[model samples]
Target: MPRAILDGTVLAESPNTVVIEGNHYFPDESVNHEHLTGTATETVCYWKGTARYYSAVVSETVFRDIAWYYPDPSQEAASIKNYVAFGRPVQVEL
Candidate 1:
């Protein structure tokens, strides 16, 4: 499995991290929500529907819009509807 880490903390870990529209979508259970702070930021994906974001704050290091999820994803992308993903310098390793 590969894990996404930020500020020395694990953000997400999964065996199947899908990249859609450039964002890496990890399984919902793979994310560590304790360090994630929901934000008002959102963007529409033509096929994925509207995606919401979370600012991952760890050890005083805040990565803006580091994580996202499609609350109401399109049927085609439904598998990752509630799943979260990372971006903007989020590091991933096995």
Candidate 2:
């Protein structure tokens, strides 16, 4: 199983994850919404389409824009649509 963690807390965990470019994309249902705060930040990936970010807020700490997902992905990355991927302060453990 793969899990997304922040500040020792599991933000998301799933066995059915998609690995793209070595990043584990966890299913939406596996994520803990309480720890995620939607952000205005957005980035475009040539093959993945536009990605929207989320800040991981745990206790008194905030990991800004550490997680992202494509709400509507390009055809090439349709399988990862709505799946979340972590980076930086958010740790992905396999």
Off by over 4 Å in 2: none
- Model 2, span 11-85: residue lDDT tens: 999999999998899999999989899999999999899999999889888889989999999999999999999
Q: Summarize candidate 1's per-residue lDDT along 1-93 as a digit string, tens digits.
A: 888988678888889888777667888887989999999999998887998999988888788888889988999998887889888678877
Clashes (backbone N, CA, C under 3 Å), per candidate, total 0, 0
| Candidate 2 TM-score, true structure as reference | 0.95
Tell me the spans in candidate 1 whose CA falls farther than 4 Å from its real position: none
Error of 1 at 34 (Å): 0.6
